[model samples]
Target: MDNVKKRAAELLKSEAVKVVIGYTMGTNGKPRAAFIQNAEDVDSLIFNAQCVQNLAVYLSKAEIKQLGKPAIVAPLNVLRAIIQLASEMQIQENELIVLGVSPDGELIDFQNFSAIEKYLEDFNMEVDAKEKETLEKISSMSLEERWKFWNEELAECFKCYACRAACPMCYCHKCAVEQNKPQWIPVAAHRLGNLEWHIMRAMHLAGRCVNCDACHEACPKGINLNFLTKLMLNDAQEEFGYTGVTLKEGNLLSTFKTNDQENFIQ
Candidate 1:
């Protein structure tokens, strides 16, 4: 932990990056985002499974941009988040630096995000036991059944945007549903309105979701929002052969290749 902190501090001191966005222990010792301005604060930064908040979410924020050329002490999920964000043009690729860390607290000193991505296929694991069970139950449902299930499940939503707020990939400066000029989404929190809002949000993240489950975790109503996203992940992989986020230089949605298939769209 100290070595990672020292390296981040050195980067800041040398002006290699203007700010280092990483994690520090939160109020209850849970991992939380920490932005280090000077070397003195580096000791506060730490990483572990408990450091669950995606650090990539903050790289595009106004305050972080003011610091200039942001660098992040990235977890695997955070690195994936950056790749997805970069593909969307939310942040410039050259302005960021990723300090890769392993699950066991070792520093992958020489590995950039791209290097880590190439090997991600071998490391992909299923979700936790309970989440896996939930995912399985959801996946087993028929399409119409699943549609009806989500409609009833999301009926409780009040358009709170809690799911959007928690998602690392949902960084739109002004979300469409919130706009009054177009008034695309109804303000009423009925099943019809709620379902459309949720669908729209999930579709926006189709090729980009890193599956951190932050959106579901952020849901106050306890809706398992991953029901929609996980389905999209399967479709993106199977139909388009566009596997989602990796630490790779170009994410599935980042660019268009002439050889790519568009049959799914038609």
Candidate 2:
């Protein structure tokens, strides 16, 4: 955390970018988004496993717009979200200054997306044993079992938008649920309404989700909302044969390719 903050402060001091977006200790000691306008503010920035919120969602905000070019300390998940956003025309490629951190706490001075492969090749360290165990458990579950598991878990949901608000990928200015003319989703709380909301949200994320798990953490019901994103991530790898892109803008996924496979469609 200190290393990242120090580097970010140096960037701010040099005027490499207008702002540095990172995380800070929140009211309850949890990590929350922190926007650093000057070098002095960088000392407050933090990074940890608990820094769960995806900072990517701030790139497209109206108030954040005036801040201009930004040097963003993005989680690997949020980096993928930025790449996906570039593909979707939500942001420009040149506007981002990204730095990556490895799962085992190594700073990757990646200049571009291709550097990720080089990093992986040089990364000979052992994977975190606990993360491997969690992945193994998640992999062992059958789809139906997983669905049933989440159904039981999400049953206590109170329809709070905490998950959406916390996510970096959910950046629509006028969410469909908020539309009064169409009212695509009802405002009242109900199982069906919640299910539809979840479905729509996940569909919107589809190839764009970066698997940050912020949605799950923000859910008051303890629902594993990110389970769907994991499923989507698997689908992206298996069906599209495309690993996710990096956070820098102007990669792929925004433009249509006629040669792309879609035979599964009816």
- Top-scoring candidate (lDDT): 1
Candidate 2 lands at a TM-score of 0.76
In model 2, the number of clashes is 2
Off by more than 4 A, model 2: 1-3, 104-106, 112-151, 246-266
> Between which residue pairs do clashes occur in model 1?
none
| Model 2 lDDT per residue over 1-266, tens place | 56777778888888888898887899887888888898988888777888777888788877776886787887676666666666567876567677676664445576864554345434322223564465468678999986676566656767788888878778888888898797788887676677778888877776666667778888877776776666665656556654555443333345445777777778
Residue-level lDDT for 248 in candidate 2 = 36
The lDDT per prediction is 0.74, 0.70
Give lDDT tens digits, candidate 1, residues 124-222: 523445765777787799999988988889887877887887788888889888898988888889887888898898788777788887787778888
The positional error of residue 8 in candidate 1, measured at the CA in angstroms, is: 1.2
Worst 10 residues of 1 by lDDT: 119-128
With candidate 2 superimposed using the best TM-score fit, by how many Å does residue 132's alpha carbon deviate from the native? Answer: 12
